[model samples]
Target: MTEKVIALDIGNVCIGIHPERCFGALGFRSLADIPREVLFLAGERFERGEISEAEFLDGFRRLTGSALSDAELRRAFCAIIGEPVPGMAELVSGLAGRGYRPVFFSDTSVTHMEELRRKFPAASAVPDGIYSYRVHAKKPELPMFEAFEARFGVPAFYFDDRAELIEGARKHGWNAHRFVSAEEVDKILG
Candidate 1:
């Protein structure tokens, strides 16, 4: 018997964002343009909601010691996110159709979360959605798992590309699969 699965997309933005995979492929290409540390701090702060959009922009500037604008930052983030796995929406709907709750889980900061919300309001990525930074979960964390259990009940299956998340789910007794591709999910569903 195939169990129900929930889908959570971890990315800067989705839905009508002019296609993706350009951020990392472009922004991070030049080491001098953007340092890994700056990106990490921005993500960290955004994930925690410790800083606002303007604050993040300022922090980014200070971190990189560069003059990148919000638009550039958005582009960079979009690139790193790549593109949504093909048929992600169908997957979510399919899981839900089976009586499984398809939820999104991302280790994101509030600033970035807001950016996504602005972009894909239809996806309902946060607030009215399933999970969020307000919950302060960074995935693969016991606390995050506990939060999910509390909010959405125990998840039967967890799909992710992170080993720590898989191990965490294992610790919590969830049927977890390391993300290989859409085919793997299809196989499980089959």
Candidate 2:
């Protein structure tokens, strides 16, 4: 059997928003500043490749009417990210080293995504075939998983933090995990 694993990290803002993950000078804030409609539109634009990072922020500001600096909002969103989820990245990377593949499936929007690319070294770890908001479609929706299967074939395991998403994956006859920690992954893999 092919022992590849397509590990997914989800986020409205990012996979993990823990403070230490913050790189530049920052302050903690929440998505309260931006509207769901605005974020959704940003995702569409990101997927369409029609706007730049600066354009996304300007439009988002106009949509939200919030005066918070982008830098502050970035810090707040980043702060919400829980710390590494205890060896989550390592576990995925270890699996990859052993011939398993790890894919980051997300529903993150365009503006936040630009921040994500700068926050994490995902480009080097996961393949470019990642499904993000820019790609349209979100988790808990079967089409994204279908696309994943189409691109990476079936993974030995598909892990996601969202139990709802996991349930959807299992429906497709895929072994899915409600990723809590590396320990859970170890338990399932072992």
Candidate 3:
């Protein structure tokens, strides 16, 4: 029998965070203030485990020359992530009850995931989490999906908040769904 998986993206799907809240909290007005490539490289390195958290913070410090302390920096970094989406716990429980293995697949760093789990302990109940920090790759990139498939043997359903990621999973021949609301997901998966 084929394994049925309900792959969920953490950000905006299970939990909500402003896209640029962290950057804004760090006093970056726009990408123009910090070169997009520089930001991407730093984030990529951090998320891919190419550097330690201290090194990642130092990269930001070098870029912005900010005098923020480590605690302050961590606070600002986690400022974006907030509460779990409405009905997320119920939705996940319902899916699992129906034999769909609920898994978390996120383009997230250790710091953020740590903060999120602390803030919402229910998130830790996910059977498995494939984080970018550990996987060294993010969604919309096939390596992440390939790794997931290699482990779970290709999910029956993949749900994410982004169109690009949904499209990417579709290309891999998975039944990918663009997660909009918990109610909608429940209706479909029920």
| Clashes found in each candidate (C-alpha, N, C closer than 3 A) | 9, 6, 0
Q: Per-residue alpha-carbon lDDT of model 2 for 10-72, expressed as tens digits?
A: 452125654333322222154453456765655466544466656765675687665768776
lDDT of 3 by residue, 54-158 (tens): 988887777777899989988988987888888887777666557778888888888988887876646646868787888888777778887787777777777
Give the candidate number with the greatest lDDT.
3
| Sliding window of 10 residues with minimal summed lDDT for model 1 | 11-20
TM-score of 3: 0.89
Ordered list by lDDT, greatest first: 3, 2, 1
Q: Each model's TM-score, in the order given?
A: 0.72, 0.69, 0.89
State the weakest 10-residue window (summed lDDT) of model 2. Answer: 19-28
Q: Model 3, residue 99: displacement in angstroms?
A: 1.9
